[model samples]
Target: ALTWWNSHVRIVGNDAADVMTWIELKKKMADTYCPRNEMKKIESEFWNLEVQEESDRVERYIGGLPDSIHGSVTASKPKTMQEATEMTTGLMDKKICTYAERQAANKRKFEDTSRNNQGQQQPPKRQDVAREYAAGSGSRPLCPKCNFNHDGPCTPRCYKCNKIGHLSHDCRSPTNANVAKNLRGNGAGQKVTCYKCGAQGHFK
Candidate 1:
C-alpha cells in the first residue's frame, strides 16, 4: 500500500478527489499533476456506480466534502462475488485441515512403528529416520571452505582408491604429477601444496 503511495499516491495532489479514478489517481500520485475538478468527476462517478447511488447525490456529496480521502468508502467487494465463494464442506475448515494433517502424520508414524516392531528397520526411530533422510548428512557438509555443515559431504570418490571415504590426498596410490599440478583446493584462484605429492598447485 505504501508502495502504491510512494510509487503512485504521494506525488502532487493532497486531496483524494484530485486523484480522480483509480487509474487517473495512480497517474496523479505518480508525479503527474491532475486537476481537482477532473478528479472530482471521476470520484463522484465511481462512488455513484459502486454504491448504487444516484449520480446527482454522488456529485452533491463530493461537492460537500473536503478532498482528503482519495478512494471511496464503499466496502471492498470481490470483483465477482459469486465466483469468490469457496465451496467446501463445513467440515473442512482451517481447524479441520490442521487436525487432519497432524493426525495423518501421527498415523504414518504409528504404522511405521508397528512395521518396525515386526522386523529389522533401516531407521530405528523417528529422530533416526529424520536424520537419515535429512538434507544434511554424509552427502552434505556445512561448507567446503571450512567445517560448516552442508547438504552432505563431498561425493567425489578418491581418484586413487575409487572409494567414497577419503579423497586422493590420503589414498595409498602416489599422486600423479600432472594431477597434482592440475588440482586446485578450496576455491577459485587458491594456491596450495598437494598433500599427496607435496608439489604446489592447490590442495584437497
Candidate 2:
C-alpha cells in the first residue's frame, strides 16, 4: 500500500501548487509549523548550532511542495545517498524553526496555566491529551474477574467470564473441553492422581 502511495507523491506535477511555484508559499510553510507536542515540549533548553543545521535539513523534506500535479519534485542532477542525507540534516534545522514558531504561538495561550500534577504526566495518563488531537482512545478496561487494571499480567482472558487467568475453553469448570471429550478423564490439569495403590491409570 505504501509503495503505491509513495510512487504517486514522488511524481512531479505542473499544477500551480507544484514545482518551484511552492517557493511562493515558502513563507506560509515556514509559518505553518506544527506546534509543540503537549507532552514532548522541553522546558529547559540548550544551544547547539550543528543540531540546528540538522533540523533545517529535515524540514526541507517535510516542507517540500511538489512542483507538479502528481507532487513529484526533483533536482536536475541526482544526488547520492550521502548527499541526500546531508541535505536532510540541514532540513532538520528548518524543522526546528518551524516547530519552535508554533510552540511560541501556543505558549501565549497556555502560558500561565498551572500543571495538573506536580510534574508532567506520564504516557498512560496522557490519553485525554491524545484524544484532543483526534488520536484514538485506549481499549483497555478493568478485568471483570480479577478486577485488575493495566497493572496485572497480560494473560489472555475469556471474553465471557472476563477472567485473565485462562481462556473460556480451558476453564476449569465442567464445560467445553470437559463436556464431550475428557480423553484422559482428568480435569483441567494434565495429570490425575490415583485414589488407591498410589498407581495412576492413564485414563480411568
Candidate 3:
C-alpha cells in the first residue's frame, strides 16, 4: 500500500503543498511503526541544514563590508548577524568623520602656508629693475645737490651760473670774462706778463 501511495503522489509546485505532502507521508510511515531512531535522525538533518544556510548568509553579509574598515570589523569578532551589522555601521561612521577632519586640517595648513609666503617680502632682481626702468615705469636718479632728476650723468655745477653739468672753471660767466680782461691789461699800459713762464708778452 505504501509503495502504491508513493507512486501515486504527484510533485507539487507550491512549497506549502510539498511540505504538507511530506508530513502526511511521515505520518503514514509512523502509523506503520517506523523506527523512532530513524525519525529522530531525519529531524536532526533538517535542523543542521537550516543552521548551515543561516551561517552562510551571515558570512556573506560580513564579507560585503567596506575594505578600508573591514579588518577592524572582523577584528571585533561579532557572533551574530545583527552584531556584525551594527558594528560595521558604527565604525564606518567614525572613519568618515575622521577623514573629513583630516582633510579640513590639511586645507587650513595649505592656506596658512600660502599666506605666509605672500607676507614674506622678496628683493627685486636687478634685471627686473632694469626692465621697469626701460619700460619708463621707474623713477629717474635724483641729483644730490639739486634734489632733482638728472637725465644725464651727474657732474659738478657752474658756480657762476649755478647750473649743473659744467664745472666752475669752464663757466661762461661775465665776471670771469672781466677778470680775464683785467689780467690781460695792466692799468699802466705795461705789457702783460705770463705768470707761469715769466715772459713779458702774453698772460698765462
Winning candidate number (TM-score): 3
Model 1 over residues 62-156: C-alpha lDDT tens digits? Answer: 34433332123112222332322222122136547788999999999999999988897454787666555554556654555323345555565
Candidate No. with top lDDT: 3
- Higher-ranked by TM-score: 2 or 3: 3
Tens digits of per-residue lDDT, candidate 2, 1-204, equal 355334534664335335445564554444444334522344323322243465455446434633331122234221343455555555556768888999998886565454544366656646665444332323455554433444356577664344567766656643333333545555676554332222334322
What are the lDDT scores of the predictions, listed in order?
0.53, 0.47, 0.70
Q: Please give the lDDT score at residue 81 for candidate 2.
A: 38
| Better candidate by lDDT, 1 or 2 | 1
> Where does candidate 3 have its weakest 10-residue lDDT segment?
8-17
Candidate 1 RMSD computed on C-alpha atoms after optimal superposition onto the true structure = 23.9
Compute each candidate's TM-score over C-alphas. 0.20, 0.18, 0.42
Residue 156 deviation, candidate 1, in Å?
39
The ten-residue window of minimal lDDT in model 1 covers 69-78
TM-score, predicted candidate 1 vs. hidden true structure:
0.20
Off by over 4 Å in 3: 1-54, 137-150, 154-204
